[model samples]
Target: MDKIINSPYNINAVARVDSDNIVHNHIYHYCPIGRVDDNNFIYDNNNNVVGRVDDDGIVHNHSINNSPIGKVLENGFVIKENALVGRVDGDNLLLAGAAYLLLIQGNR
Candidate 1:
């Protein structure tokens, strides 16, 4: 979790995945991406637990009132109840059929 703070690799905020968004040297195209706290927990605007990414590259599901919504494996495979849901792309975005951004909706 501490690595997230001093992330040697910067995961810069990007413009929303939209065609209108130009994929050039656009500097303003940024979203208030969620923060990974010291405790390694991500929360939504409603103060609801969203998810977590630990030092092991394991993304733990903390959604559903902090219940086990699912887990995103290091390989980006989302598993829920031992079933494969979907996978996360290079952009760290999941394309699950029932996908919902586990992060907060807007700027927190």
Candidate 2:
């Protein structure tokens, strides 16, 4: 495992696989300077970010080989896999398959 501090606000870390030459994992940690409120972005052996842990401690995984599965909003909502979910006004909810649920509603 090799650690590299790319910037003051982010840390880029990588770990190599012993068996496969092309297999490696890259981690991107944000806001590692002061606050412990950091997020982890994980990549697969193919250099593709397959998952991410948000600041809210929600783990978002890829559907298929770096494909977006879902995201965790600031609010406490576990949007399960293959579900039409979104957020509105800081609230995360299911889109009901008819309406477009806003994942992150801006302060408007």
Best-matching candidate per TM-score: 1
Task: Give a tens-digit lDDT track for model 2, residues 24-86.
Answer: 222322222111111344543345444554545344444345444454444423344644233
The TM-score between candidate 2 and the true structure equals 0.26
Worst 10 residues of 2 by lDDT: 95-104
Top-lDDT structure, candidate number: 1
Give the Cα error of residue 91 in candidate 1, in Å. Answer: 5.1
Q: How close is candidate 1 to the true structure, as a TM-score?
A: 0.36
CA deviation > 4 Å runs, candidate 2: 1-39, 64-108
After the best TM-score superposition of candidate 2, give how far the Cα of residue 17 lies from its true spot, in angstroms. Answer: 12
User: Over the stretch 12-63, how does candidate 1's per-residue lDDT look in tens digits?
Assistant: 4322222321111113323333333445465443555466655544445554
Which pairs, if any, clash in model 1? none
